[model samples]
Target: MAMPEYTDGVLELYEITNDESEDYPEERLKYTGLRIWYRELAVYDTTRAKLSADSVEVTYKLAIPQYKKINSKCICLIDGEQHEIYNIAHTTTKDGFKESELTLKTPAYEREVIDDTERTE
Candidate 1:
């Protein structure tokens, strides 16, 4: 099964789709309060970053118009490895019901066990 592509870039929590089917449609515009998974940032790189799935805390608008259900744990593929986020949070925009950006603080690479058989010299 092909997985939907989700980037770690700044995301705007829109809304969740009210579908009665089992398969979640990617075309749905509704923003589900779900943690988006993405690649971890390098530990040494000290620079401004956007709100990604790895973000520990997500800052949204001050006035939360609605809330969507999200996965407590999510997997993000970086460099081909899967990384998981523990928790996710959302806030209301200070101005109004606008797109809020969430940021994550995580190590560039999430430690993973490599298979020796896959190694090549």
Candidate 2:
């Protein structure tokens, strides 16, 4: 099968800053605006503690002049929201095309909002 057309979605990749001092140990993620051809699928569920969580699965196709490496330390920004990348699964390459399935976690604030909306409806 041919690769899916990714003209509709853009993948935003981020890098984690590791500038931490003895007194201040804080790491921040910087958005590089490096977009790629991709598609996202999300699933929302509640935990046993009644906490809401979202698992955002992204299918990203490899592009030329690769921007940044996709790893657990990276974050994906979709639709103006940030999702923490937890796992990256590489699929078998075909026709010189490579793709990866990224498992991302939704931010807490976004999850809360989704939970609230689900409750109201």
Candidate 3:
């Protein structure tokens, strides 16, 4: 089957790398400019709140090539916003096209504040 061509929008996939240095222990997500075509499946309000605030659930339909690799550890950058990929299901469309349904959750660290207060003895 041939891969379907999508003209909706481009999405960037990022790989999360854990950096554990003495200075900082953080997860670094890097994007290698791997752009692909993806369409928005649905965006609705969720009953659960994220970070003690309201949130929404988003789903995307990605037309990825059969040889491409996508996993749960990957994050999707859409419209300058990072979304965590929770579930990925590969399926063949009725038109003989390979597609992947990505169920994304809101970013975990949306509005993180850094506290750099120093303690004086």
Top candidate, metric lDDT: 3
lDDT score for residue 19 of model 1: 42
8-111 per-residue lDDT for model 1 (tens digits): 33222222233456575322233233333332233223322334433543322121223334332333333433334333445444544432122333434443
lDDT of 2 at 48: 17
How far out, in Å, is residue 93 in model 1?
1.6
- The number of clashing residue pairs in model 3 is 0
Q: Which stretches of candidate 1 lie above 4 Å from their native place? A: 1-67, 98-121
Question: What 10-residue stretch in candidate 3 is worst by lDDT?
Answer: 112-121
Highest TM-score model number: 3
In angstroms, how far off is 87's CA in candidate 3?
0.7
Q: At residue 99, what lDDT does model 2 achieve?
A: 62
> Which of the two, 2 or 3, has more TM-score?
3
- Please give the ranking of all candidate structures by TM-score, highest first, separated by commas: 3, 2, 1
**Considering TM-score, which of the candidate structures 1 and 3 is the better prediction for this target?**
3
Q: Pairs clashing in candidate 3?
A: none
Model 1 global lDDT (CA atoms, 0 to 1): 0.32
**lDDT tens string, model 3, 7-93?**
778777777766666477676676655777775564344423341264545444355544247787777777778888866778878
Can you give the TM-score per candidate against the true fold? 0.27, 0.58, 0.66
Task: Summarize candidate 2's per-residue lDDT along 15-104 as a digit string, tens digits.
Answer: 666556547645566655567666554433332123222333432323322233678776666676777765666664465455676656
